[model samples]
Target chain A: MDRTIAIDVSHLSKTYDSYRAVDDLSFQVYAGEIFGLLGPNGAGKSTTLRTLITLLHPTSGAATVMGYDTVRDADKVRTLIGYVPQERAIDRFLTGREHLQLLGALYHLTKEEAAKRIAKLLTLVELEAHADRPAKTYSGGMKRKLDIACGLLPDPKVLFLDEPTLGLDVQSRLRIWEYVRMLKARGMTIVMTTNYLDEADQLCDRLAIIDGGKIKTLGSPVELKIALGGDIVSLTLKETDRIHSLESELKDRPAIKAVRATTKGLDIRVESPEKALPTILESANRLGCNIEFIQYNRPRLDDVFIAHTGRAITESIPESETA
Target chain B: MAHYWQEISALTMRWVRRLSREKFSMLFTLVQPMLFWLIFFGNLFQRAADTQVMQAPNYISFLAAGVVVMTVLNNGLAGGVDLLFDKENGFLERLMSTPIHRTSVILSRFIFVMGITSMQVLVILGVAYLFGVQPATGILGVAMIVLIGMMFGIGLTAISMAMAFSVKSHGDFFSVLGFLSLPMIFLSSALVPLTAMPGWMSFLAQFNPMTWAIDAVRPLILSGWTEALPHVGMVVLVMLVFDALCLYGGAKAFRRAMG
Candidate 1:
């Protein structure tokens, strides 16, 4: 009921027959903030976004965009929000300029108004030179930029971007991130769903880490890292056989909380890796185990995900490829 | 309704621009049916006239009506393929997310298909005139037939678009539309008159809506609306029912697809 809430979802759920795609999910995106739904594939991130944008109906509970009910007042919600789907939703036959023109028209812009907005959006996305070319001719990044540009054409108060940079090159991803930041700075409330941890860390003001249709945790990047307890000391051992000895030796160390063997190496969550380094090395020396690699850093989103879900995000992607 | 009109205008403009840019698709729209008419229908009519089975004044004129209607039907039904492609490419989802009225999407496609069909009809009519088939009606009457024929075409298009939403793949949709169209064209008086067929064939033709449409426009092509009014009413009623069914089904499908 808060007027400052750009999006308010309460116990919202979506079930396809017997499968619950989104299970009693609840979250709020405040005005003028960049909120992220971070998850792996089939984590219901896209479904959540689709429901918020009124593209899909939720089975239970409720959601609202800019104070309008997503289901009962879909047209109003649609008018207030812009949705950028995970798959590029552009017409290949239309030029970038024409695509924007058509989208603007769909948003109820007059001809003159549409044309002016098209010009400004083209410049904003840095696709002015390629505006006249068919979208099929655009590079992956160019297509993504144009997709984002189309989403912004209505000057919407809330924008939902689902996997905006899924297949983009690093440079293109960074460019999109920059534009997203600019939108937030200009008082646009953005709900972006991304599987990429680094993207959420860099762009999101706060994030909800979702997995298996549930919210694992929700906090700012720094808050999440701090919640994971301490910095991580990751090491790649020369011999896999030494993992057991390493775990047992460092298990009760004052600076170390947990020592687990991962595919790459042993991951030791520590209060202070800088202080724990000498002790860890001495333990390795005692065991006569050679270290192939060692890294000590603050916990990443992936670590936070692992701490909550007990699985890596990358491996959690459904292998079927069809969904 | 105003929003629907605006959507139609915007979509029509988009199609026009694309057609202009592509050039070849427009040319294809004009020439493909002409080729079918010239080869298949022309040869059949010539053979029928030479054998003295055709008692009508001009056999080519009789065939011309069928060709024009067939062109409209073919183009109208195939227009749904664009919607299928939109689904495949994700444009449908984006369009659904906007504030535009849902019926406007269907109307826009109907308008585009109708426009393309009209141009094809002109080309067929020109060909008919060239082949020594004189129109019994004036230009206005001929226009009336074309407009009525286009209404039927729009109805078929609505059905096809609805099918696209209901069916899973483009190939499945094409199969269904093809199956429906071929039998309707063959059973109706498209290629030959019902009087020339057996009693059971005539009975089948009585129920075929295409038969009514062909009968309705045959007079306009042969002698104009004075004699065609009864058949025109029959055709219009059939088309109205088809259009209503398609619109209802398409709206349901649209809602399902969004879900």
Candidate 2:
């Protein structure tokens, strides 16, 4: 990658009345990289994307897309970016083809150019067969495909997708992931937000784990997992009240990196599970806490989230926050 | 400037296409005004109303102008329903995020409503012809009536769009729409002549724009160009000021919603 910055957000903050939706945040998205904002609902992911797309004005600070200031040169910035919002924006009364045709006109394409581009995009999203059907008849997956096709109408340099695979079936999600990778192959910079762990791990080149409208940590999935040291040993104990005692005992070991108590029990991060397994068993036996279940595995993104925010991402935030 | 109009035309065509696809709505929108107001109510009141007081050949001929202007008022006030739906569904956000001029959205809606209002006015005139009501000003005068209807619609539609942007929900918008349309129609000379109206209603009707529009259109249908021209000029001047205030409020509401 040439490391050209496609987007630069500096101290971007947005507030609704007294509630701060997006705090003073800063980040840079490199050209041709699929950057993901991984957070639970209401963690400021959509607000961040909306600001970058110029759908909103920031309360303070600034952002730029392709060097055009989002606030100052909004029209120029709009020419370079496409946004797919979290809500389904399809007009149920309009056919799939009509939607694209209208979008083409908004983008200022000539009649012939719009027709040609619409045909190509319909084929790309595999909606050509049902192009004449009203969007109300489309399935959930098909509607999302149409939304993606509409976003691609401008041949935008950057695409902002808010929860691209949200409410999608497994097959539809896999197909959307394939399409996203195809776009990245064509060198389009994609910035997507998702609360799904597997989506962030499988699709994003790098992600920022966010909480309470703040970025808890930021890195590639592999780098974040590796940063947790070696392996995670999760143990379920019968004597749940004595769990804190085991954490203190495990914390004294030089080989142990960190220990966290979850609903499932204690998760101990160790340099080597093989060397630390026997010590763990002996400590449990000495403490008279019966180990009902135990397992060891390489660090996953869940552990990475747990390591930074001190809680699992899925259970960390309430779902009441508007996406 | 060319690109701006092009975007507006594209958006206008979108509304045109959507309405065309609704086979039921298109049929009813044209038919309902004539069926209820012109044929049924016009005949029902044929014996009750004094044609001499109306200064026309019959009640229906005098009522013809009322129905025409009434169509413009109803269509214009209901114009923003589609936009309110678009806002709620997030399609408005999608359009705003595009590179097109923001004002094009409002202008395109204005064109679409006026086009439909013009079509309904023609249909109402045709139905009135079947009932032995002819415009004394002839074909050119009929064209003028449509133009006047569109001019009056421009102001009502602007106010409707402002309400759409200002209200929090469709429920509130509908409430406001109902509140404005029924009262405006009753206070005007649509259902009855100003000479036959109650003293207080006649006084209120003088201040109503609907009354100005109806009064302007009635002369074109019942009297010749000599009688119609003066009323036309007066309504035109009144509409210019009405539209200015409406568009100003509409633009302010649009800016606030966008922000």
Candidate 3:
């Protein structure tokens, strides 16, 4: 099924004085699709999301959300998108019910409409039983639910989620994933950013791998891996001896497209793992390189990333979040 | 909620609800700080009643206007704590992302601060009345007293919010609060008459809006319109300029922060 574009960003850049947070980055999100911005921390994913949401203005270029310019038509754009930031934006002093009610009023919903909507949201987020309790008593997951509920108050067509599951526990993250999927099913276009490769792999129908304010790669999970084609075969040698010869021959093979050296061994990208493994072993033996360990893995978003950027995405998340 | 008035009221109701839930913080914020000035200082200066040290018959009557301004002082100076908290918690960003009018944020805060200040002012007036102190201009004079308190309150609240938006952190905000609050209170006639203050202090008090508010209010309580009218008019004019300046700066900081 062909879908309309929900968001169009063109050469958008945001600079904070001497720092270029997002530089000439661009991507398009489709209607009713969950489009993820996949990157490590400080990869300008959040900066791009913020620009699209109208929280931060672009230093150059333009973005339109639901056909309204993000800068010039910010109020109109605001009306059509709900934003959930990485931080817990809930006021702990207010009850869960109060938070929804407050947002309802801010959105100019009528009393009856607000009450009805708030009730439905509370049930949807599974916080109905604790609706009247202060959010300070809520578990982290419950608080996140309330935060999402606040964003949904306006019933926006497009939702902007910046690192929504960044600090959440596994259970909380799964709950959010379920909710996001549900929202997509209900015809909401969700644009989310995440450092977790699995989240982008699981939730995003299409994603952009961004680094250094540029989209290094973009496609559906299957398409991206297929485009980079192959299994990731990392083999560690006993020493650095003949590793260079092995790397050169691995690249010469028709099935292997890219081969880069890892600290431990060679990260070779082969079109078909089963077909390439025997040949790779023979090549290593022929080169007189003693193999201490070998690993054959399915191609993941990380491998796709490494193939494009020449560096592995460090999976250490919290340390980078702090930085 | 479609009406502009309804939106402001609804926003103001949020602050009121948060305050109501934290009853202890509300009670302490309103009562404790002024307890020393009202109970302790009023008694310590009891001897001033018989002397011509002040124009009023007793020191409490002389301290009455000061109490009202002090109420405004505490309420106004701490006004930005909520705004700063909202900024930190990302609520301010949330509110801005919505279609709600930006001016409503500031206006609702003004309404909420003035509402709480009115209640505190009433308590102070009621206590002074119980001490045999009555406004020479009657209930009309009491109304004018609250009006002057509000005018000064709005200016301080604007300044607090401006600082809240401009500063880097809450610690810096509180440091600013500590640096400014007591000096403004002491420089003004909240604790003593202008004549009794040293020459340099008295000269500085003339430029302090808190002093202008208290001086304007004191006459209405002690000697009625004949003496209070000019001071009241001057305070109104100064407060108008003060509010304009503070609001302009506050709105600028708010816009810059949002950007």
Candidate 4:
């Protein structure tokens, strides 16, 4: 309800015949925040993005972006938001500059304003060197950058990026992250949907872990990890025979929250790795268990996702389905 | 309303810029088919005047009208293919997400087809004149020819666009195009007149809308307004109904696609 909220989706649902895509989903993204809908395919991230951008009408409940109702005031909402879908929408025949000019005209921008914004976008995406080349001639990463530039031509209030970096190499993907950071720095509210957990971890200010068409949990990356109430303990062992017995002993201890044996050693989750490690070291020494290495790391978003969704995010759905 | 037109214009320009770069599409869709009819068919059927195969001043004049109608058919039906590619490739999804009126998407397509059809018709007419076939209806008859071709073009283009939106893949769309295009061309007197055909074929050609178009356009090229007027009036009425149905159906199909 705050005026600073850029998008407000409440109990929104979309169904295709008997199969529901998004169910009873509610969230608010404040202005200048980079919010992510983190989920595997069929978890309703893209569906939510589409509904908010006014590309698809929701079957039930209410949604708004910057105070404009998505359904009733869709046209006004259109002017206020920009969207880049999973697939690149560039016309292969046209040069990158031409594509931007055309989209600028669609947004009713003046010639001078369009030129200025286009130059700025090209420079921001680092595509100015390739701006005049036919889009088909550009690399996959460049084509995607052009798509993002097209979406940004209107200088929209809310930019929705649905898997914008999908299918790109790491370098190209990072370049997109740079563009997004620049946009956010300029005070633009960005709503992104991605299945890549690391991407959500690195780029999103806040994320919602969705599965089965429902929001399982929502919070900032640090907040979600902290709320998981555990630190990761990974131990590389010199011997494997006593791995199960050692894990069980560690699990029985109040300090060790959970323990599992990894290929190289033992991976554990505990209330405090520092407090749990000394006892585990003593137990290993007493049991004649040989250990090669031991380490500790904070809980990641993937751990948070698994804790809330009851399955690892990567294993929730096959890769093909998510793409 | 003004913003609506601006949106349509902007979208239409997108098609125009793309088409301008494709030499093959420009040539194949408009020229090759027309030239084949004029040279091979016209020369082969030159002495058919003795057989009464065509009811016109000469084979050239008779074939000229059919060629014009055929151009409209080819350009209109294949025009939606670009749209289908755009849809499958995600360009259409991007366009729909924009702020413009959605109808502008289809209208720009209509304008693009009509623009290409008009140019092709003129080129065909120019070639026919060079070959010594002059219209008795003169410049006015030329205008009438364009009018008939465009009206027919509008309906077929709308149907093609509807199918583009409805079909799942380009493979399925090509199958539909292959089935309807040849039959429509052959059954409707694009290569032969109704009277010259067997009784059964002519009977079916009566319901074939292309038959109506050629029947109306042939007189303007050869005889005069006096003979062409009644057929023009009837063909225009049929074309209007056909266009209304196709445009409405195409809009509904497009809406379903958006959903």
Candidate 5:
């Protein structure tokens, strides 16, 4: 309930029939911070963002954005927030300038004010050259830029972006990331949800990794990577059965914390992969097994997800009747 | 009230811009109704004349009033499809999240449809005049007919938008349109006189709001406002009921959709 909290979600739950899309979720986003909701597809990240934006009502619990209750004060919430959905919502029939002007009108800006904002926003998104072209004529990156420009028309206090870079190319994604950073630098509060681990790592000040409609972990990127221990040693064995013996042998080792079987090989979380790898290789060789591939690197957000959820982030989620 | 006017102006401008940009699509929309008025109605009235069913001094003028009202109703009702398209394309959600008054969304659409309908009415009226169908009264009566036609148009627009919000598929829209149009046109004295119909048919016509609207305006075009004030009052009352029902239903549907 603090006035400084840009977003306050308290034990929010949303259910579709017997399934829960967002389950007993609680989080707070501070003002002027870029908060990332990181999760794979169907992990309820979008659901949580939608609830905060007042697009979908939660079955239980409550959320407030910029000190206004999402449900009770929806109009006020709308006035204070800008929502950029996953899909490009710009009218293809309308020019980019016209689209922004119409959106500006919806925000109650007069003609002169709307024109000024439209010009500024189009330039900010780097779409000024193509401002008069219909949105249908724009490329994917241009369309996305226009979408962002539309969201910025109101100069909102809080902005909710759901998978903003989902379908963009690498260069366009990087461009968008730069814009997001600029927004953060300008002291705007942003709540963004993305399945892209790299995006979360690059743009988010703090992120919450959600899986199965629950927050698996929450912290800054460095904090999360630190929580996974020292380093991850990935070893591809010639035989899958060798993983169990390797795990059994390494379980009591001083440098290793845990060794689990991965699809390509065995992943060992250790205090120091550099020191433990030589011993692990000697042990594997003495056990008469050949190592196909071996790699030791810092833990990634994907590893953090696998460590907590016991599944790979890239795997398709099993279908449930969850809304 | 200023906010409402502002919203209306904003929405109206958006629609006008869109129509101007998509000239081909706009032409397709305008041509169908124009053809119905110029070709189909013209031929149908000519046949009726051969049979003496349409005994008015100028059948084309009588038919012109009905055609204008019909065009306005059809265009207004069909405008909800644009809302449905906006919803499907995700634009509606974006709009809903804005600070604009929600009622303005529907009202803007009504204003847009009414404007388009007025343009089409003028074109059809010009064509009717060229065919030797002259209005008995001057500009005031013509303006009154257009006003009543627009009111009825707004009501249908609201009802159509309400349905668009409730129904999930485009197929449902076509089916609903087909079902509503024939019954509404037939129940009114749009194509023929109530006296020429059976007793039950005439009774049904009396209850049809379209009948009241057509009757109120037909005299203005064919005989001037020798048409009684009570007749105009009846049309206005019926129009008020339909307008209220549609506005209420559309707003309710919109709230549910937003949820």
Candidate 6:
């Protein structure tokens, strides 16, 4: 299927004083697609998003949103996009309904239009019961939901969410994911940045694995994993025979692609774990090696990230958030 | 143009709502100056203040104009606190990301501060009336005083907002505010006539925009419009130059910060 580009960034770079935050980067976001910039903290994901939103000017190159230049036609670009920043931006004193009303007014929505949109958004975000209460009294989840509702106020052509669920609880994170999917269902193009492995894999239709101010790799989650192109079989052998002989035997097997010795045991790469596991066991049996433990699984997005960046993304994920 | 008004009014109403919600602060913003300056301090020096040098019926009458302009100075100098808080809290960034006219952010703040300054001015006038003081130029003169207070406020508020955008944090902004407010009040004619102050102090007072504002307002309360109009005209000219410089600095700082 042919898709029109909603956002095009060409060789964009942003430098702050002596440090380059984003170096020579280029990508395109298609219409009606949920695109994500997957990277660790200070990996330049937020800088790229800010440049596209016209908040920060790119030091070199340029970006366009809906064909409007982000720099030359910022006001025109601003009208077509909704941005929810990583930081919490809700006014503590204003009630949920009042926030939406104020944003509606700023968006130049008439009184009747603001009222209609406010009511619908309040209901949609499930904050109707607490709509009149001050935002200071809200939970973190409620606050994030309120921010999302605010972003949806303009019914924007593109929505930019910067770490939308960075500090949210599991329940709130799931709820946000649901809302993001619903927005996509309504044909709204979304650009989000996240460091979570599951968030990138589960939420993004296509994502760019950004690292050190550049695109390390970019593709659908499935395509990236398939590009790794094999299942991994990990084995821990009991102390009964020569591990080197077992490794050599597995290396000669046609089903096994490669074999490398790990501290615990052997890590063997193969086309199909189901077909290769029996052949490896037979070779180990011939060598009189007792298999204490064995585990086999398909390559995950983490593996794909490691393949491109040579570092596990799990290292950057917080302990509690690593599912 | 319609969009400008709509956005400014909407943003200004946000300030109004927030201010109204903080009942304690709202009450104190009006009553604090009145309690400390107009009633206690003014009456404390009622007997000590020389009427001939003041050229007024009494101390309270002369102090009324000082108190009104002083309130404008205090409120105006601190006008950017709310905007600074918005910046710190990240709401300013959100507003900037929207399609609204960016000038509306600064303009709305000006409108809100001036609105509150007008209310405070009226409250001080009403209280001064109870102390047996009245504007010599009557109702029109009273309106003129509020107008002057607002004019003086614009320059001070512009300076305050420039600091808000320029400073790295609220702590630094407060430090600068403390450094500025007391010296400005003391160096002006807010507390005493220029003749009563030392020669050097009076020389410095002449340079204070606050002094010009107070000098402009003193005649409206103690003398009539015939004596007051010239001072008003002079202060208006001074404030215009003052506001232009402040607003230019403010716009520069705003551009750098927003960028």
lDDT per residue (tens digit) for residues B82-151 in model 2? 9998888889989988998978898899989998888888888898898998889999999999988888
Q: Best-fitting candidate, measured by TM-score?
A: 3
**In candidate 5, what are the lDDT values of residues A232-253, reduced to their tens digit?**
8889988887778776887878
Q: What DockQ does each candidate score versus the true complex, computed on alpha carbons?
A: 0.61, 0.65, 0.60, 0.66, 0.55, 0.62
TM-score (C-alpha) between model 4 and the true structure? 0.90
The residue pairs that clash in candidate 1, if any, are: none
| Model 1: lDDT of residue B246 | 72
RMSD (CA, Å), candidate 4 to true, equals 3.3
Candidate 1 C-alpha error for residue A246, in Å: 7.2
Which of candidates 4 and 6 is the stronger one according to TM-score?
4
**DockQ: the better of candidates 3 and 5:** 3
- Location of the lowest summed lDDT over 10 successive residues in candidate 4 chain B: B48-57
Give lDDT tens digits, candidate 6, residues B124-194.
Answer: 99999999988889898889888889888998898899899888889999999999988888999988999
- Model 1: runs farther than 4 Å from truth? A1-3, A241-261, A271-291, A319-323, B1-4, B48-54, B195-206, B223-227
lDDT per residue, candidate 2, A35-132, as tens digits? 99988778898888888888788999899999999999999999999888777899888999999999998999999999999999999999999999
Candidate 3, residues A20-68: lDDT per residue as tens digits? 7788887889999999998888888888887887878888999999899
Candidate 5: lDDT of A211?
85
Off by over 4 Å in 6: A228-297, A306-323
The predicted structure with the larger lDDT, 2 or 6, is 2
> TM-score of the candidate numbered 6?
0.87
Error of 3 at A168 (Å): 2.1
> Model 6 reproduces what portion of true contacts?
0.80
TM-score of chain B of 1: 0.90
Q: TM-scores, in order shown?
A: 0.89, 0.90, 0.91, 0.90, 0.86, 0.87
Error of 5 at A238 (Å): 4.9
lDDT of 4 by residue, B167-218 (tens): 9899999999888888787888777778778898888888988989998888
